[model samples]
Target: MTEHDQQTDGPGQSFESVWDAIEDTPAEAANMRMRSELMIALKARIEARGWTQAEAARVMGVTQPRVSDLVRGKIALFGLDALVGMASAAGLHLEVRVSEAA
Candidate 1:
């Protein structure tokens, strides 16, 4: 890679990967993506348990349509707080940790 590209990517990181680092995105966009990913993961877990959206809604205290939206990756419409609440209601605890760059 060119020196400019290496510098742009920070040290030796490459942009050739299909999806590279997005961790440094602005707060709003990062939260949006995080919420979306969490929703998808939660929906998958619910399905893996062989549960219907209606059942999941009952467990999560949300309407079935909300669960459907999550399953469909319309995550931008929901906030991280809402997702965290739903996850807890659905018997999933959200765990996150921050560490210094390694």
Candidate 2:
């Protein structure tokens, strides 16, 4: 790999998620993890129901372009609240859990 593409951490340093490795703080990483999980869930639900982008958007109460961004895994285009709202609109019940950090 090129020098600019190299990891800065010491050899063998590991993270629970890529977000943890790249985000500026633990809170940011946690937020990204939640957002990513929600996106994946929404995408899977759409696929499972055999819904087109327009159909998914209609069900989620969003525009087709928004659904396109979602299914394309455009994490940077969404936030936690937005994802939660979309999931709810799509009839997905969500639960949050907290645990002590390892």
Find the candidate with the highest lDDT and give its number: 2
Candidate 1 whole-model C-alpha lDDT, 0 to 1? 0.71
Cα lDDT of model 2 by residue, 26-61, tens digit: 999899889989999999999999999999999999
How many clashing pairs does model 2 include? 0
How much is the lDDT of residue 42 in candidate 2?
Answer: 100
State how far residue 16 of model 1 sits from its true place (Å): 11
Candidate 2 local lDDT, residue 56: 94
**Full-model lDDT for every candidate:** 0.71, 0.89
lDDT of 1 by residue, 10-33 (tens): 676654221224445445545655
The prediction achieving the highest TM-score against the true structure is 2
How well does candidate 1 match the true structure, expressed as C-alpha RMSD? 6.4
